[model samples]
Target: MVSLKSLFDLSGKKALVTGGSRGLGLQIAEALGEQGAELVLSSRKASDLEKAQAHLAGRGISAKWIAADNSRDDDISRLVDDALGKLGRIDILVNNAGATWGAPTEDHPIDAWDKVMTLNIRSLFLLSQQIGKRSMIPNRYGRIINLASIAGLLGSTSTTQTIAYNTSKGAVVNFTRALAGSWGRYGITVNALAPGMFPSKMTKGTIEQVGMEKLTAGVPLQRIGDEDDLKGAAVLFASEAGKHITGQILCVDGGLTAVLSSS
Candidate 1:
């Protein structure tokens, strides 16, 4: 019988988290690191990566950061190569680097739409391809965690218009399922986390625009996702405990999606 502690332990595992300089990416990095997984964090801004590295160091979590723009193909290729060179092999890949644009559908800019889709979805595919072919497939074991959103499961609100972000995230949902189906042959488990209203730089505008009271009211839990809300879910999908689970999207939304589903 496998003890729960042993099942959840990730000691000796190596992880690479994209967009890990801040927000949910950083949170997930904390989770993996606390579980004893060696970590490599990547993002566009060196400054932010420095701060994140310092924070992790304060917690005694060993981590290294590679600054690269996931929106650019060249950068993503280099990021994967750099991570591979440093870590020897990547046991976990967190596809968390993303961007968003908010505008009425009719008035949305084409450039903005492209930017969001390319970074949110395209980079995810490119990085996964490199990591899977070079590392996971060869090793026959891996965990891939994609960061999706509750917005992917539902349409945009009247007040907040993000057609590009929504469409891209919706793609992430199906992408998770599709990839899982194809990759399970190699002992790789592909999963996604569709988070709800979390207070972050990305959701700050929407939260302010929609009002906290209304947002919480719609959630059955009557509260918003907090700093540590996503930690457990992230660790579950990244560790041995979730070995049997694949192609699943676990929402960390404090019951917001559930409320919407019923109503």
Candidate 2:
């Protein structure tokens, strides 16, 4: 019988988290690092990475940082290379870097749509391909945690006009499912976290525009996610505890989706 602590222990595991400099990415990074995973945090800004590294250090978690823009093919390649160099090989890959544009479906800019799709979906493929080929597949063990949004699950509401964001995340839902099916034979587990409305750089504009009270009004919990909300789920997926769980999309949205399903 596997002990609970042993199952959840991530000691000596090496992880790479894209967009780890802030917001949801940073929160997940902190969770993984605290569980004894050695980490490489990546983002577009070197300065932000520095601050994140310091923040992790203050928490007694050591982490390495590589600055790369996840949206660009070249930068994505370099990020994988640098991360492998730092950590020897990645046991876990967290594809958290993403972008969104708030525009109506008909008036959305093509370039903006491309940007969202490229970072949210394309980058996940590129990084997973390289990392799987170079590391996880060869090792026959890996855990992939994708950052999906509740926007992916629901249709457009009157308060929001982010067509591209919703569409790209919806693609992520299928992508997570498809990849898990393809990669499970290789001993790799792939899953996604679908967060409802968390206060972050990405959602700040939407929250401000929609108003916090209105956003929380319909949620069964009457609040948005807080800092520590995603930690347990993240650690579970990254550790042996979740070895048997794959292709699942766990929503951490304060029962917003539950309300949606019932109403």
Candidate 3:
């Protein structure tokens, strides 16, 4: 019988986390690394990647960093190639690089919308395609975790307007399910994490704009997500413990989505 601890262990597994320089992406990286997965972290900024690498090293979690603009096709190709060259194989992938532009739907800029979609959803597909075809499919095993959002599951609020971000993440949710069905025959499990208010660079502005009290007021748990809130869920989806799980979107929202569902 497989021990529970052993089921969650990711020893010897190699993982690639996009947008790993900070925010929720880094949290997930910490999760996988702590579970003994070898890590390759990627983002657009060399400085941020360097900082993240040092941060991980401080915790004794070995990590390699790559700086690349995943919004472009060439960069996506290069990222996959370089990651594979360095790690030899990618057993888990975390699609976490995303951006948001806040504006009323009528005033939302077309260029900004394109930017969010390209990075959030397009890059995810390209990287997953390259890695799945080049490694997981050939090896017959893989775990792909896409970063979605509670916003995707619900519409925008009066306090916030992120049309592009919400649409793209909704796409990510379905993308996770569709990809899982398509790839499960090859032993690849695809899942998504739909997170709520996590304090990070990307969310700092929203929290500030919406006010922390207002943000947490409606949440059943009455608080924003802490640094470690997502760790366990991320590891579960990335390790053997979740081998039988696929096409599921686990929300780390402190019961926010549940409240919305019942209301």
Q: Which digits, one per residue and each the tens of the lDDT, describe model 3 over residues 229-255?
A: 999999989988999999999999999
lDDT (CA) for every model shown?
0.94, 0.93, 0.94
- Candidate 2 lDDT over residue span 214-242, tens digit each: 99998889999989999999999999999
Worst lDDT 10-window in candidate 3: 154-163
Question: Cα deviation in Å at residue 57, candidate 2?
Answer: 0.6
Looking at candidate 1, what is the lDDT of residue 144?
98
Q: What are the TM-scores, per candidate, against the unseen true structure?
A: 0.98, 0.98, 0.99
| Local lDDT at 182 for model 1 | 97
Q: What's every prediction's RMSD, in angstroms?
A: 0.8, 0.8, 0.7
